[model samples]
Target: MDNLVSVSLRERGGRFHAVFYDPDRGQKWRTLRTSDRREANKRIRIAEDLVSRGDFDPWESPIPDRYATLRGAADLYLAEREKGQLSRNTIRSDRSALGGLCSHMGPAAKVRAVTSDRVKLYFRELIDDECADSTLRTYHTRFKHFFEWCRRERLVRRNPLDGVPRPAVSDALPRFLSHAEFDALVGAVYSDAEAKARGVVDGERSKHTSLHDGDIVWLAEVFFVAVETGLRRGELCAMEWSWVDMASRSIWVPANRRTYSDKDSFGPKSRRSRRVPFGAGSGTEAVLQRLHDETGGKSGPVFVGQRGGPLDGDYVSKRFKEYAGQAGLSEDYVFHTLRHTCASWLVMAGRHLVEVKEILGHASIDTTVRWYAHLDPTRLNAAADATFGRNGDRLRQARCGGR
Candidate 1:
């Protein structure tokens, strides 16, 4: 008993508890859920063996029935999410979405008590609360993971969310700026830059133009780069000077490394690295060349704050909104619209979906096609012509004459 490395038995709440030290998690105190001393001792030995093998998460492996509450399921799910190497954003979002569920159904609600009917009713209430369909779908998606974990762990006989229907998401055409609007937005930024250079001091406008003159010019270039490369906001911000291959006129988007982190551990959302070419006529190459000259070949972020830290994505978005407003664009035109604008223009210019998919770094051609299908004039025309071209008149006449 003394050799078993801090594993000991104790009595708590009329049950024997297995108490031990877990280096990864601090001191762990688990109820044996049995009054028998022999069973408690055996459990302690098992825990010691599990810890030695480096597979001793109290939340996983040989899951116990006591962890059958909604709260327990959530804890276990989040624990697994961490272990599965999910991104921080995904883990944070799951916790938030599931936290709402635990609050609605008391935390103590049994996993076995969660029926499909109960899930359906919960979504009905969410719908009535004026939650957006997309938001409702997200909650449903989170619960689906929880329920699947519960079923796999045998906490529930079946996934209660299995039969629950997800909210129908409307595939509205993505909001994007037209070529004219994009030109106007970029022009506005440069216009302000010109005024700043000329020392036209509009006191109130100064607050809005607080970014350094160089940053204002860079923002204009960012717009050009975004439209040319179609990089995600984070990908663009996380970009480093080294990743920009000026000779090839390409930027390499590295997989899963946080450019904003003190440590370079956080990566791209796509979890994959991709090389995006700067468009031939977008003038992005020249802009990047100027940026390269300005940065003096030192390895740092491609975009940085005035104080010399990496540029924040949110701040960039806020400034873009201000720039768009100055150009008389709609409030709904967001930074992401730059991406959509690029994709739209590509399809409009008769580029194949495969080409668009590669440039945008989309995982699937279906995704590229779905979003930009409307902009592809040839796709629909080709489909119609495939069945109705050249021989269609002859076929129609033969059918009528034969009848």
Candidate 2:
């Protein structure tokens, strides 16, 4: 019925401005501060809505200019994420990446001022600093998300990272421990536990190693479960007793569970649930039983720290490195290597790729194949035998004249 708000392009700098009529202040116009016609139109709708509600303020810009700064936008984005369902580790990672970006490009830099060339330059500097390809990819992804948020909020006309190509990362095969190495690592855990019980001074023990015999057993079980079930460190740390079924020898990783304020929350990386089974004699059942007994058969986390709280993922990794070192394993080995070791062992044991995919909770079979298909040669050999092998056998018979 009425032309409540309209957007017009200013002739001076080609910037779009909002022109609106205010009942209290009579006819009024305010700059939308956006050059893009589409963004300006969106802001005009916002202004119309504000006017209809009788809260229009001509002096104050509809879009807060303060949030246009890179630092301000990043902080707002992070604060919003912190209030959402994202995992703490994920929020921490976003904070770290955004902090790096703000440091690299002066914090006061305007979000709209970021250009593709500037982003490329930042990446180039990162490359010069010898940042790993994976790390570079992480930074790129974080920046892309941040810019997308800015675009959605109308803080920027468009995402600056739209034209930038993602860094190419090498497809390195997953590393795994050999059987001998695995045995040695497990033996080292037991040895360390015994040493601690005997009060023997070992120079190689990590200063953080305050594990008693029970703690040592718990750590060993953590290693066994990680290598056998292929659970991620966070999943293992947040694993609850209810998720494990000793009778079925299965661990149910659930995507949805009621999270109490007193408990740490856990969700799989894929955000999907899957069951991981362990063999009867794999010692997994025994390990779970022992832990169950020690934890008083309560309905709480399966693994806990010295303070009877959820295990810290970082601390588990640190202790794993020390144990790996004591076992004379390669320095490159980390807790995730145990997951790789699990998949490798499963594939080598003739488990199907799809089965390994489900066991490892991989979102796709392609990922399971990419990491472990090569480890299982039986299927490849069988296929070759079914095709070329038959032909070769017939050719050999003909050549020898049925001798």
Candidate 3:
């Protein structure tokens, strides 16, 4: 056999070993199958010849063609998702969760290499980093869906997430602004606009655009409409002049205006379209009329940027936070808090869950109940009185000698 540079022999425990440099396994040192020195040398030469021929792959267990890296499978999964009717928001969330996983486990790490233990550890790290349990649960769901897809695609032998437990999320009620805080926020918004108009507040600009007097006033109007009609921020931004019916005193939330993108128009979160009527003497009609007049009855978006383009959601959220803070609201206050506030106030005012659900354009009544059920203690109390009140009173009289 020809001499090989990377092959050598070593004596250990009275046995001759053939040691060779394997590009894949780093270095291979194995006892020769034969005890004879000539046989061990021959084996070493054969290994070296394979290495030189570029045909040696020393991986003990070879990866199958079905195995895919996390990143590779995610690309396939997301491509599949995009081809379907999945919302852009859902796809964005999936991408975000996939990014996190790719960061934790190397992007090139095989999907089959992931185990339940790794998933548990990843969540542990997230919790340690102070990620909310709710957020962790979202991550868990994204991973679950990804793994399920991988299993169906045969990219993984089995779902690594099978035995992994979902992170427990709290059933805490959504936060909403109080009546006093709501009033304060409104005042702050209007007052800020007035100040900017009067030159008292000068050169106050947002990252996206300048906060003009009209923009501020429009935002205030948006706030009022949000409180009255329970429209989401994106919905408000997507609202067109044509959707408003002054004669009928109603606003149509078209199914097409749900998404918030760089486009001129987008769709709503709920794919279904519905109408929200201005309540009898709710004064919401007046707010819409004034907004229409203030914006010069534009044919396009009711709320626009300084350049009269589609309103930037981030700008609105930033201004909302600025005004909310000035109102002395809690730090956790966000634009969505207004929607929560609307539902809470409705429930407190004795509106039915179904009514709130319709106003909010929720897909189901259960969603409305889960968020606002705690606000309706009166209704629950009434039910309790109807079901157990008399029976409990009789039992109490029996125990207390009718005292």
Candidate 4:
């Protein structure tokens, strides 16, 4: 470890950088990690060693600065995420939440200067703005994670986020459409656009042909598949034609996403999400299969973009909302509602909770149970009726009447 001091750098941002020290006439200045004293000093030693071996083309780090800005850290995090070793959605969320912090603080603000008071204030502002506790918690979680990453990278000496309390949201059961409501929504989709308040279609063909019911019908179909299959939005969008066997009444979820570098990247937000097994009636599966069969075969996407490309999840949600509106539903009831509805309906039909959990592809039966706990009352009522006896009163009356 050579004594490091007297540094000078001409530029800062990726690749070759030179920091000079000692006698100034060394001429061969070593590449510094960054202009920061703490960073340059730490790396100067390593660079000197690397120089001795002639492998001195500096390490080239994703971290631009030791104490990085929220945006910079998130960018680095995203780069690491792009390496395909972690969940893409998780990294995406980290970027989004951390970027929100950058929006509050200036983009170039340093992470070391962040304080517990500032974090507290941010959460308070969230409350004042009427953000949901769940959403607020998401922001805090992202912040906490960023700070932890900072600690590992030695950006800060101590974790200011350590004592921070997390916001608690009620783990309420999901609300789903009733059977009649589900049917009404389905009917609205399969019915006339004008009748369903889906408005009208464009083009000269408007004089005769109508396609208003198409949107709702499709949404309903998508909804049914969600509740029945318990597939996430990302999983549902990735479905291919070959994955469905309507005659056998099954949909195959590959549990992978097509990445920029990797093919069929592991999916479903987890390694366990690698596959989904589900059954659908010919009414839903048949139509989807027929559409693909009519066009080509099992090679292309089952659900395609307007230009016949892969369907993005964002686009699907937008379309799902517009289609759901015809059934007099709110944005509160999005595509995910179909998933809840499926679990709720199954519980209502007297299926076992454990069975429901497995079918839904939940990480734990506890999660499945928690999400549908509101449906427990229905389960309990039937259970009580069967166990306590629907004829308990009759039996008691016979004794009272001295029969």
Candidate 5:
């Protein structure tokens, strides 16, 4: 490997000639020629300084011998992440957050040139204006990650967020489905007409070939899978004929499938990759198997759009609402309601708090407890009893301890 900053010269016709060298294993570096060795040396010095300062990647060309654009700096940051075997889903998530910054901050803004005050103000306004906590956290996480990238690349002299504090949020349980509810959701809830309409499927869902009969049975199955499996919309969409292993009875979560969110208009949710364990005989996998048997199983997305792409989640939400209305379920319920329902069911089943935490991918148990604490009064009561010696004893103990 050749050092990008090393000075090297090739003489043309015995006259002095020089150019900056960038090593490529499978390709040759192209040089921009300079006439004078002294000028060439100056150019080399600037190039080396710029590269050292993280103005550009060591291998990238067209690097300005000056400040790098936020876009350019981002490229360098992302390139390293890509090389590190980071999942595509994770990369996309980070990319969305970081790209949103460049888009909002302006393309010309240099990561190195960005000041502390500007960043502070940016977050301040986001919080003060009452942007959703989740949304603000996304920005903060992305910004901190970008700054960390700068630190790694040596683009910034110091971390911009060193003094900044991330907003604290109480860990709340995510909603999922209950067993009974999931059973009801996947059973014969959808009608022949509604399923025939291919409710949630975007124009992309129609690729399964024309259906002559009711697929409500299949739709019901799909709803169960969503709630039971906790698979995101994109994961559901990207599933293909081969990913399903009926004998093993688990649907393989493909790392390459597109995310179902409209945040980027269309595509995978992130580059983060993981295979989910889908069970056999009941819940989601059963519905998937039924669909597989009907469609030839050799075609495109499992949940094809009306246009033959994966079903858009937004459409799913609307369709779920319609189904709920028809079934007289509450209106406040959304597609996400299934997720909540699942969590509720887990708590109801007396699953360990840690087990629920892992199942939901929650970073903390406090999150799980927050949502399911109502269901586990005994656990809290037990803890309270340990600390204060039962309800009445706690009152007496408090009076004595205070005295």
Candidate 6:
């Protein structure tokens, strides 16, 4: 009662207050609403008993309220998230995950009623529906964030997600295109363009018009830049001509930049800027020069859609899939495969993982190693030979006088 609960009088209001110390929530105060010393003492004793029983939260109500429902708290949580700097996509994902959770667990279910066992059952249902482990992990992450917010807001006594286990996603290697596959993919782009041009000339009914020669060239350059620079689709679409330094052969990917218009705003996924370099002979400079000349305007987006605005990242992925399909590549190949291809090729060419990590703008070297290290078995073999092969044995024998 001494440290866990204390009673104090408000000199100005002439009312008694009950002070309680919660290990998890820290110090909390509750107004006893009585000025009489005897009544305040009785309330203080009750508070002490509640503290001893580990039910000392003053915010918890004896009766169910609107905010006590899962649906109501989730709405408030999402509303608060919308006011922050989080991207719209993040908030949308949060809403999607929460919507599924609310639907599965009855919208009016009490927030406190969501036990760990219930959450485990929900995840089991998701698994039964054949949700991929990666997708399940994303849902789990969103749920964790949502419930943590609820806990901080005192909507629930504790985060139910804390008791639930995270979904286990496999550490599968990233998918990448082989050299022949890469060539075929690029060739497929030109082939499709030519086919469309032929359709236009033959006056055949086609759903889409043929891309202009300049646009075709831009598309090819986009592919080249993606595979070579390992830029994310968002980074590629958001890139500006000014970011390309032809003199230094580097692309300056900014951490975050805001303009007067939201359309022109962009930032790296990691929220850290980096300099991505390209070889002089890698055709990147030539491609940038061609794009610059074709656009006739040097300050706006490096990649633009038919309307000349910033290219949509989602569209880029969809378009890449089309080209991949045309090239007879596996449907699993995605736009991000270009990034994996870049890292894979670099590692195969004897580049250090640290170098690949920097070039790819990865947050950690571990990520670079995890995805590309297995592709460099030659390097590992070479290292092993250098340390324990015939030459190493000879040197050791020479040092030990043939022992």
TM-score for every candidate vs. truth?
Answer: 0.71, 0.80, 0.72, 0.72, 0.58, 0.77
lDDT of 6: 0.77
Best by TM-score: 2
Of candidate 4, the 10-residue stretch with the lowest lDDT total is 257-266
| Per-candidate local distance difference test | 0.76, 0.79, 0.76, 0.64, 0.62, 0.77
2 or 3, which is superior by TM-score? Answer: 2
Residue pairs that clash (backbone atoms under 3 angstroms), model 3: 256-267, 257-266, 257-267, 257-268, 258-266, 258-267, 258-268, 259-267
By lDDT, the candidates rank as 2, 6, 1, 3, 4, 5
Off by over 4 Å in 2: 1-64, 201-211, 257-264, 295-298, 392-403
lDDT per residue as tens, model 4, 22-101? 45345344444243455455555555555455453333332234336666666765565556566556676777777777
The predictions' CA RMSDs to the true structure, in order, are 8.6, 7.1, 12.9, 7.8, 10.5, 9.4
lDDT of 1 by residue, 140-204 (tens): 88888878867655577888777988888777878788889999999989887877765554533
Q: Which has the better TM-score: candidate 3, or candidate 5? A: 3
Q: Flag clash pairs in model 6.
A: none
Q: Which prediction has more favorable TM-score, 4 or 5?
A: 4
lDDT of 2 by residue, 225-256 (tens): 89989998878887888888888899999886
| Inter-residue clash pairs, candidate 4 | 189-216, 189-217
Which predicted model would earn the best lDDT? 2
Candidate 3: where are CA atoms >4 Å away?
A: 1-67, 198-212, 256-260, 263-270, 280-283, 294-299, 381-403
Error of 4 at 251 (Å): 2.3
User: Model 3 Cα displacement at 351 (Å)?
Assistant: 1.3
The parts of candidate 5 lying over 4 Å away from their true place are 1-67, 75-92, 103-107, 171-220, 240-286, 295-337, 354-374, 379-403
Question: Which model is ahead, 3 or 6, in terms of TM-score?
Answer: 6
RMSD to the native, candidate 2?
Answer: 7.1
